[model samples]
Target: MLVSHQQNSILKHESLLVKFLTKYLSRVDSDIYFAKSSRCVTHSFTKTATVLSMANDGTLDALPVVGLAHNDDKKIPRKRVYAWAFWDWATQPFNTVLITFVWVPSFLTSTFFLDPDVVGTAGEEVALGQLAANLGAGITIAGLLIAFLAPVLGQQADRTQRQKLQLMIFTGLLVLTQLGLSFVQPGQEWFWVGVGLIAIGSVFNEIAGVNYNALLVSVSNSKTVGKVSGLGWGFGYLGGIIALATVVGLILSGVLQGDSALTFQLVALGCTIWTVFFVIPIFVSVPEPKTRQVGEKLGLWGSYVELGRSVKRLYKEARPTFWFLLASAVYRDGLSAVFVFGAVIAGIVFGFGFTDLVIFGIALNVVAGISTIIAGRLDDRFGPKNVILVAVFGLVACTTAVFVLVDLGTPMFWAVGLILAAFVGPAQAASRSFLARVTPAGREGEVFGLYATTGRAAGWMASLLWAVFIQLAGNQAIYGLLGIALVLLVGGVMLLFVKAPARSPR
Candidate 1:
């Protein structure tokens, strides 16, 4: 009976204190008067009840333990967000030129890695199988390495408050790595050299993206993050389109010298120049987010321990973050293989010539860029989960068509493949937005680093399946493309199991 009376008195006092703060501090520092502490709210509430009963001047001073309501939803500048989005545009060539449409399959697999002497005698099929296997192996190795490195590096970046610094250093290295590709001539020896440089560039790109994605929270709040993420992803696809067109124009006009090793080399150099020109905006404008409480300084090994603890904590307090990471990781790998093998399928299975490949790339990027931009608005309105669910389903359906209608030739690839392209960018953008929506405030770098780690951990799925299917199906590129589709199909099914928050947290 006495305890119950004391509880009532505490509740009455807390109500009176809240009313007083609401009236007096509303205009002064309402948020400061009652901000949500980083600690457990239940624990903070218990502490606040004791202070309320005391009702002393010092007790009022301790009010921050039970924050009235800190302004977590403050609007950031538009220019700062655009500056951040430019980073995606700046780096798109790494995907468009090096990994996907232009260089990987068109030139590297056909001209550089595929030896004419060996291919002529052993048959193109046998040579292509070897080339595909080697390409898959190199990429798989790089991804495995990334899985090991990304989380530790991200945690350290969070601790050191060096997201932007790390982004700049690694991104500069990525540009340098791309520029080095300009020297890769058409020869067997140069093939592995090209692969090595590309793999390194891939690593740098992933690491830099960890920081860039983390920075999203700093530039936009919950209401605008989805659109902003979509803006960045859309810019990337659009930039890829322009870059592809430029290369095609240069090659066709004799400016790049068609069929010469110099043509592809010039394309690589152009991507390098484009990266240099555009990445400047992000470095100039988006300032680094300030670091929060740096709990006991951990060494490299200790950081992993810290990461494990964070994961455990996240699972308990933020189940959405943990589940979404697993779900997105699966689908994202399939999305990656779409671009990774898109041109490969066109060049090898569909018999697209260099011009056809370049033109096809232009079309693909245009649809992807435009759809991603539209999806951004939809994401803000209908929620990122809905946007992703729709896009991923479209991808799965397109994948089935590409397989079932394999004999239809170029038209089928153009139609069904573009359908696949339309969804890839939206799903990718929404996944990033979804992560931003669930990320705990002040832990952006660590959470996003885990984001990179989770994705890279499963990165081998598409490439492995690509290699496996081709090997089993008589070294056919069509069979290899089916492997990627299977991955997407599986990922989409896995996503259905994860119960994503139906809407972005308002």
Candidate 2:
């Protein structure tokens, strides 16, 4: 009887092992579907398959940490994944349409917003420089606010499982701010109001992003997280391409023909509507993340204390994650400066017209989307840290080339600028994947919140240096590129010393 029982136990174990290997090996480029059975073969150094639970119907409940939940069906639904990705598509116009390509450069700093007296006395170049400098200052202030609020809010959301709710509230605020932009008529009186509105909108956007990024675990497993992150970023770039193209089409079609202020006002209104329409799918289709044992919730002050303790714990236990946050913070600021100032550089330095800037934005998004998707696969194969390092190296080289070869004119800017765009999305996507990998179970919101806080804490460095460098170089916008490149270089070197997270078993 004892010998027979031992033989039955060994057969069962071998059957389970074969089951896991079959599903794991079947994984392809985009996604991998595991069995609906309430069992998972979690990664372990022992190379042994361990079952967590069992259910008669075989439907698997979510696992801790990585948030892998299997639906009743055998295959993961594509709809839920796409719906989650659409959130990125939805919010992208805030960056591409309002912040980067259209509103700030073409209208806010235009002659309409300048003091008639200053333009006459100081020349348009000097007036534009002042406006640009002021914009940087406003963005810096917004970053500080994000640094203060993100960690506290993130912790509360993680403990309470209110990530989706918080994301919706902040998303609403962001939309309202964009709506408010329509009322920012072009004049000296309205310039600061425009700056203030954009600043507030920026804060809302970053906070909302903290929750959205944390939600990544809800829809992905350890195996597919890199690809899923890349998909979301790709969607964003593709959305940017469409939004910018629509604006350009409107401009060329004369549908948006009017005074400069009215044209820009219409653009802002269009973006607000776009955000509202596309953002609904995420809230509707993607279910809220399941709650876990992330400790008890704390009040505002207690939350801050908790945050401090969490930081200390991270430094001690997850040293690689801690170092990654610090390193990513610096380069992320530089990456942000590229978009925040790209249009301004094109218009002010390269002499790109309104249509030309829009066209350039369209082309930039096309390359960015494609490269990010391709790099996602590379991230899974080579590891996210390797992918990030390569992208940063490319960014540094391209940005430096843009600054040094400025006199070569628009052709040079277009060539090097497109190449620069290609690296930006890949670096951003891989960074998210890296963080997702190291985050502990049930702590996605809090960790990504720290990610946002750290990024925002150092966020002022690039903006400040951009302003400082431009001022030091006689307010030449082209010199600001050097400041951005320097930040990337420093961040890349820091990343080299930080260890990469261990890869999960295939």
Q: Provide the TM-score for each candidate, comma-separated.
A: 0.80, 0.83
lDDT of 2: 0.78
Candidate 1 segments exceeding 4 Å error: 1-73, 111-120, 123-131, 407-409, 463-486, 502-506
lDDT of 1 at 99: 75
Clashing pairs in 2: 65-441
What's the CA error at residue 82 for candidate 1, in Å? 1.4
Give the lowest summed-lDDT range of ten residues in model 2.
Answer: 43-52
Q: Per-residue lDDT for 323-428 in model 1, tens only?
A: 8788888888888877767767777788888678778878888899878877877886787878898988788778768878998988888989888888988999
* lDDT (10s digit) by residue, model 2, range 1-506: 01123345433543563354335334572344332323343332112112223433432222222343322123545556677887898888988888887788778877889877876674888888889889979987998889889988988888988899999999999999999998898779999999999999999999999999988877776666677788789888887777777777667777676356789988888788778877988899876676465777899999998999999977865667789999999999889888767777888898988678778889989999988877877887778989999999899899889888998999999999999999999999999998987776667788899999888888778877888899999988888988888899899999998877545445
Highest lDDT: give the candidate number: 2
Query: What TM-score, to 2 decimals, does candidate 1 have?
Result: 0.80
Candidate 1 lDDT for residue 275? 86
Distance from true location, Cα of 402 in model 2, Å: 3.1
Predictions in order: lDDT = 0.72, 0.78
